[model samples]
Every structure is written in structure tokens, then in C-alpha cells.
Target: MIVQTLPGRRAFIRENTRLQAPPHTPELSLHLADEVTPIWRLTEEALEEIGLPPPFWAFAWAGGQALARYVLDHPDIVAGRRVVDFATGSGIVAIAAMKAGARRVLATDIDVFCEAAVGLNAEANAVAVDFTDQNLLNAPPPQADVLLAGDICYERPMAEAVMAWLRRGREAGARVLIGDPGRTYFPKDGLEKLAEYQVPTTRELEDLAVKRTSVWTLP
Candidate 1:
């Protein structure tokens, strides 16, 4: 519907969300929608009616929070490396990679709104994170020393496609890392668990106040 003008999107983000630190990664702040925010009450159908994308960029999902925490705690994983953050909702992982000393980070998402969301978030954290609305799965994975993805295994088809693409990136020499909260579609094999956490979340978003999430690497 062409409703996502950059200025409007930025204003929407600022007006509907607040800059807050994620529970698991308190060192970084992001513009996130909380229970008190108007956006928090919006359903997918309502958002679609208003020509807005699902508000994935408006919250710090458990997977992204855990992955960001892991990256910040173990900076060596991304330090001095070129990184790509796939499905970078709110750009939490990308910002973490930059804070962890990555040489550069390209945050990619199909949702056009994320460009605005990530820009605001990077500014909040005082970090530089490049963002694109490109669907990275369509091309050869960009050259990267580290590739990060989080909370992307919700739907079956998307999970399969993303995992396949991540595997290709791993085969091409990029170290691929994923953070998940045991979604039904998340693969049950062929990954190395690096860390696990009882990530604090909101029941309104995840139907639970705490989620057991984990960070995994594609070896």
C-alpha cells in the first residue's frame, strides 16, 4: 500500500516505543514496544489493515536477546570480523556484533520498517550498523566472517529456507550462529549448542514470562 514512508515509519517508531535495555543485554538500549505501548496491542490483522508489517522490529525477542548477550560476553566471535545479521529484527544482534568489535555489520530484513527501527536502535546504542531491506536469501551470501540470525524459526517453510541458506554460508567459510527459543520448526539436529539461558520475556509476546533459549553454531 506504499504506506511506509521513512519519515512516517521513524515517527511511528519514536511515538509508539521507548528506548530501553533488553532484559538479557542491559548494556545496549533499543527502541522497543512494551505492554504499555499502543503497538503492543496490535494484532497481525490490524497491522495488515493499516498496511504495517508485523511489529517484529518493535520488540527484543528472546532469541535475539540471548544471541546478543552471547556475542557481547564472547566478543571474540565477532571481534574484527565482517558480520551479516539475517532477519535482523530491531538489529539487536547486529548492534551487539558492532559493540563486540566487529569490523562491520550489515543488518538485513525483508520488512521495510526495520530500516527505521534499526536506525533508531543503533543511534540509541551509539553504534554504527548498516541496514538493508534486501532479502539476502535470494543471492549468494555476502562475504562475512560471521553471520548471525535470531528468532527466525517460527514457520516451517521459512525455517527450512533460512537453515539451508545458513548452511550455505557456513560452507562458504562464514561462521553462522543462531539463537532460538525451541520453536517448533527449529531443526533438532546438526547444530552445536554454545550457550543456554532462561531469557526473561513478556507473556503478552511469548505466552510466557520466561523462555529457555539457546545460542547455537553451525559447524
Candidate 2:
């Protein structure tokens, strides 16, 4: 508790978690918490003592897993392009883009701890991925050839905000891709399904142990 610095937060992550491959994306490995409940409970309690939010950076969610798998399979989507992974938790999709031979990859998240997590995961995967702690929600979409977002539609407001920003990215001529595990706020219209996967996840993270996640592009 009380992790005030980036190093302190990184150390807490390293101590509480282990480097392992997510079940749905075995090609890449990340430093992740072992059980969802322990870290969830700890972060919940630490909210008062540490002023840290829930450790979303510690788990590979179903949407990220399926998106990573899709990227690895469809290298042409990112090959030689500047890619941005928005709301990158655990940096799974950004790492996958790098491994798929992207010219560059930038992973962005609101949590500063995610910078450390993304850096560690990039090093482990032998891919160079840049990280940013800025929220980038209200700002203009940064220049990129492609934008990847996974599991971003969990809440109504967040889903609406990011969708609008992502649409701006698409209008600016960047291909925007979203991965969702049937989140309620996902705009069912105007998205072309690029790929789908049966992503295995812990029940602690979702209602089902196996989630059918899909990758969609605005076209």
C-alpha cells in the first residue's frame, strides 16, 4: 500500500504477480497477478491507504487476449504501420502489434503504473513499445496508421467517450479497431467484424469463464 512513485508501484506489481502467458494468448507473456480476487481486494483496500485504483494493468482481459491473437494471425493489419493501443492494459495488444512487425507501437493508459507494466511486458516479449500515462480521452487522436482498443466498452460513459474519440481517429484516415466481449455499450451498428475468438478468462473478471470476444473495424 501507499505506492507513491512509479518504481514503488512497479515493485508492488512484480512482488504480487508473476511472469506468465495468458491462457488465450500463449505467444506472449506478461507480469500478471496470479489470482484476480487477491489483487482486486488489495487494490480495493489500498484505495484509501495507497490512493491507487484497481490494478487493471495486472490482468489480460478477454478482449485483449482475442485481439492479440488476431493481430498475431493477421500481421498484415499492422505490418510496417504506426499503431496505437488505446487504454492498453498489460500492453498485450501493443506488444502483439510489435511482434507482428509494426513500424512503431505506442501504448496509452490513464494509470501511470501501466507505463511500467507495458515496459516490462515489451521487454519480456522482446518488442519495443512506447507508453504514455495521459488519458487522451478529451484530446485529439494522435497521428497513427492504426488504433487498437480492447475491452474499452465496459461502462456506458466511458464507452461513449472512447467511441467518439475513436470515430474521430477513423475520420482522420486511421483505421480503428475495437475488441469487445459483448459489452452492453458497444455500438452494434457500423462496425465490421474482423475476427472472433473464444477467449478463456477467469470468472472473477467476467460472468463466464470462456468469453467470445470479437475484433471490429469502423468502415
The superposed Cα distance between candidate 1 and the true structure at residue 149, in angstroms, equals: 0.4
Residue 149 of model 2, lDDT score:
96
Q: Would you estimate the TM-scores of all the predictions?
A: 0.93, 0.94
Query: What lDDT tens digits, residue by residue, belong to model 2 across residues 1-219?
Result: 555676777777787889999998898999998777788676556444564556789999998998889899989999999999999989999999999999999999987578888988898999899888888987999999999999998789999999999999999999988889999998869889988889899877889999999999999
Instruction: Output the worst ten-in-a-row residue range by lDDT, candidate 1.
Output: 40-49
Candidate 1 segments exceeding 4 Å error: 1-3, 40-53
Model 2 weakest 10-residue run by lDDT: 44-53
In candidate 2, residue 69 scores what lDDT? 91
Report the C-alpha lDDT of model 1 over 18-64, residue by residue, as the tens digit: 89989999999999887633674453333456655457998999999
Clashes of 1: 0
Candidate 2 Cα RMSD after full superposition onto the native fold (Å): 1.8
Pairs with backbone N, CA or C atoms under 3 Å apart (clashes), candidate 2: none
Error of 2 at 6 (Å): 2.1
